[model samples]
Target: MNKIFALSAGTLLLCQMGMAQQKMVADKIAAIVGDKIVLRSDIEGEMVNLQRSTVDNTLPPNAPCMIMEQIIAQKVMVMQAERDSLPVSEQDVDGQIENRIRYFEDLYGSREKMKEVTGYSIYQLRERFRQPIKEGLLAKAMQDKITSSVKVTPSEVKKYFDAIPKDSLQFYESELEIGQIVIQPKATKEMDQYSIDRLLEFKKQVQEKTSDFGRLAILYSEDPGAKENKGVYILNRNDKQWDPDFLAASFRLKENEISSPIKSQFGYHLIQCIKRQGDNITVQHILLKPNVTRNDLAEATKKLDSIRLVILNGKMTFGEAVVKYSDLPMAKFDGGMLQNRMNGSSLITIDQLDQPSERDIVLLLDTLKPGGISKPMPYIDDQPGGRNGVRIIYLKTRTHPHRENMTDDYARIQQRTLQLKQAEARDKWLREKIPTYYIHVEDEFKQCSHIAQWIGSIAKQ
Candidate 1:
């Protein structure tokens, strides 16, 4: 099931549980919220990705009947959110939009190509998606309201562990202990001026031809992924993954319009709007980041070299330097530590490291035993706003696979226990609220085995 999820989603926001045989679509005017209509498409689209990978590809009358009941219940909660004037922030939407773009980018390959295939620019796709994404996020929040209060005592966890048969227990494939140091090179005045000068010249050329925005992107844009997208990205209304300045400026453009140079931490961008629909827009952009020079990189490396020497000489410790110098906020509190992002395990496994850091760290660690330090070396972390850096790391500790026990796996166990509690609470909420909503399951599904549980009180047997 996990493998199926990976194949279908690779990081899609949708959550799925292993279910069996469910293939059906309906066009019922299921319910209405003030001015909005809830069609079968809305409910079923939410589950299409789920059913695609579930063990049961067949749509049992029982499962659809139960899910339809849940859908109507979700609508009621969304309606309540509207009535209460609950709001979602633009920051959140931008982040979500970016995440969706990445998913589809992975799905379709290249943002521009996705635009060509989907027949909607990234912006247009995102705008159309914005409301649905918001609706989904809001619905989840509402679901949380019902399930948030559920809690499990220590006894519940022991019971949960006991309930699982010995052979049925889940064993993690592996774990790792990792140490890292990072040094970020500063952008220089000359490189910044050069990039700004190029944009200024490009703006002149754009003004001269006006019809060749796409052509210019092909020739000069440095953003490799989006350039393949023809310098264009779709904006979805509920997308939450974009840089804010990028999102706002794109939406503000008029059709066939070129925007002024927009600068962000990523670099400089020149935007051309291809189309617009309400809050969403499809726009192409050329990005040029000032590249760090050899001297600038050398300076950062030199600094790390000094730190490495000090630690090796016993003047200072690697953890102390990490506390003093690492810029990553998430790593700062952990003493500039490197952990497997998948599970936050201190040791990164061979398969877990995707960047050059994995090989570099392994080689560095091979030369040192526990409590030993590595020389300053270059490493790259694939993160937004991540850049080339040099740092020294210390091998803190290492662990090997063992039977799951309380001392080493407390956090993972606690989370699973909480999830079990939450699932039960959601079921309890459905049992109580199912009768209150105006629900009318298709008569074909009414006699299914699960229908009574979905709609609360059952008729006499």
Candidate 2:
């Protein structure tokens, strides 16, 4: 996800302590929205959180000004929500706040570790964040309500689509709408013994050698997020992605202590607790993917090949075979049709195809066109993940690049129209309601590009 160019809470909400702490006491009110104050720390905190939470970290150089502008917009929204008597209940606010907390906990390691990192526990964190989340949600709801009246017609969609210059199109190198039935390679007793022995040997390296765990993680860790990061990053206590058993295990460790191999849905891991705050902990970990040999791939492909043979020999239609025998739950239900993850069309542009699978699909589909099918071919999505598995693909369809029309692309246009209409509505609401809220610029950002329309002519950057 892109670093949301939105202005929001930056530095700290409420956390107990972290694995590490930034020494700078970076708290300064950059703007005020009704009773809510936007702080420089808030923006910085969010940037840190966003960097850790999501992928994209790019920011406009005048990010503080951008954030301050959002504060003004939010203040206007809060006032309007109150005046309109929008009934945002306490339970509603608490629910959203708790979800975020849980996500943070899971992300960082545990609630206690998160607290140690942030200097706040889960309960205190919730209390500190409740009003802000409520206000943020309320403002979002008001904006939603404001945009609810906006609508675009089919003609508008076509006009918008056609108005785009040919060169302006965001082109993918290639894309595919692929279907698969996956079967995970079974991890049996002997494999487990082999993996555990290997990890145990690596564990002995840290214990016997004059070295620490981070150095070991850098050399041998398979975790992409940690391997290059020197095994350090902040995670909130409430994150939901990590396994609960693993999280519970992480919370019990002291600094520099190594964990016994802990198994999760993904694979087995060996972790070294880096630091502990209250409910949070920072840890470096090494992950080992379960060994899968060519024999394993061949075993899966052989089964799929048999199924393909049965279909070709007229024992069953391809669709019937997909529904009955294919291991891919998602594709089996769809009769082996796949949706484009981006545009949601059945269309597969040339650039949308994934690598390894891309070359395979292109070669397999050389003679075929749209509404065609492919012979069973090996496709792997078998990353060490919760939903990891291997499959043989069936290419259902491929569409050439052409002008997007209603017959081929309704959902894409509708979603785009909806977003544009919403943006227009939000801009309209802010332009009208901002004067009611108290706002000030830091003098440096007074001359921003978009502020004068939202605020007034008094401040110039």
Candidate 3:
């Protein structure tokens, strides 16, 4: 299993304290690979994090030993990455830390609650995570380098499958290939003007000092993150994720100055530059999306209804219909097929449809058979600016629960085979690299059977 080096702020703080408090005895090194060392507290900290985060609040037997091995491997990889001069940028590391902070803040309800729970301010959390996050990035870079060229041929996949005992073969639940054609109703030009005017008014209020930008954002911003973040975001000018128009507008503003309402894909926004430091800019904005009236939605429904007829009448393929009519951004690439978010596979299970909007459509799947398309139904699109939209679902294929077989489950088996091959390649690389490093294991962990190879390497040294 691939283990990510992610510990919550609270756990990380405790671990840091443990290392500091143990200074009287001198923080013991659990193991060393090349110039990288794994501190004893690092293992304990990860154990605590895993125990708390696990679904059952329990850990597997020998979990510590497993964690020790994983951490040592990471250290080795990080050392190799440095030798190879893999480029892990400060911007990338900071971006990961910022994302983690936002995630925990969302989890704990707000920034205040997150600070209360974690006992660390965002800045402190960033400082604590910086090294570990950077090390993780380096390790990942090395792992990717090791496995980059590994591939499995069809014969190898078949051979791997044949080796699995018949009775031990995997069982699979029913899966589905679901497709959709989403149509977001366009607001009339008058409604668009109305939204733009509202944002302009908000900008005027802030400029006149009648109200602050954050207060107006809290009250009126349609952005989901506005409730907690008050429409504030730290943006990197070079990050491609931000809407180009929005980013350009933000970069144009002077610190403490608010912009006239600017339109982006999401809607109209009045952005205030809170701070600027080189490429990183902190900004607050109030977003106002144009309202979609019942008539607008009905028109979209009618249009989808017409498109559905064209598909049902065999006049157009579902893929063609999606290409010509679907408004979803991903439709251009995926032809409206919903993919498993975890794996990007078209095959999805009912349980995988966890979002409310997806569940609504999943309920309709009970009546849909292979190649069946449902009537256009109204759903609130879950995207940032997607308030209300209409969609028609296409059930391309449905699988019955069964034992895995080469014929029915080739794709899944192929994926597993490829993963196994990659793991083998990584192990081979580790075997070749370990002997070249100066290895060490403290007396406490010397008896861990999993580390015997490292201990032997140390003996050879």
- Using lDDT as the measure, the top candidate is 3
Clash count, candidate 1: 38
List, residue by residue over 46-152, the lDDT tens digit for candidate 1.
45654665787755544454555455555656665556666766656656766677767876666666766666666566666566566656666666676677887
Tell me model 1's lDDT, rounded to 2 decimals: 0.64
Candidate 2 CA-lDDT value: 0.63
State which candidate, 1 or 2, has the greater lDDT. Answer: 1
- Candidate 3 structure quality by residue, lDDT tens digits, 94-207: 777766666576567776777666666566667777887787788888888988888888999899899999999999899999999999888899999999888888878877
- Enumerate residue pairs that collide in model 3: none
lDDT-better candidate, 2 vs 3? 3
Q: Which stretches of candidate 1 lie over 4 Å from their true place?
A: 1-26, 30-38, 42-47, 55-62, 76-87, 116-119, 147-149, 177-181, 198-220, 225-262, 269-286, 302-349, 355-375, 380-387, 391-398, 448-461
For each candidate, the alpha-carbon lDDT, in order, equals 0.64, 0.63, 0.81
Report the C-alpha displacement of residue 310, candidate 1, in angstroms.
9.8
In candidate 2 the C-alpha lDDT for residue 24 amounts to: 56
Q: For candidate 2, lDDT tens digit of each residue in 186-259?
A: 66667777777777877888888766667776776667655557656544466444677778777767888888
The runs of at least 3 residues in candidate 3 whose Cα sits more than 4 Å from the true structure, single-residue gaps closed, are 1-28, 52-57, 85-112, 121-134, 153-167, 185-189, 202-219, 223-258, 271-285, 293-336, 339-345, 383-386, 458-461
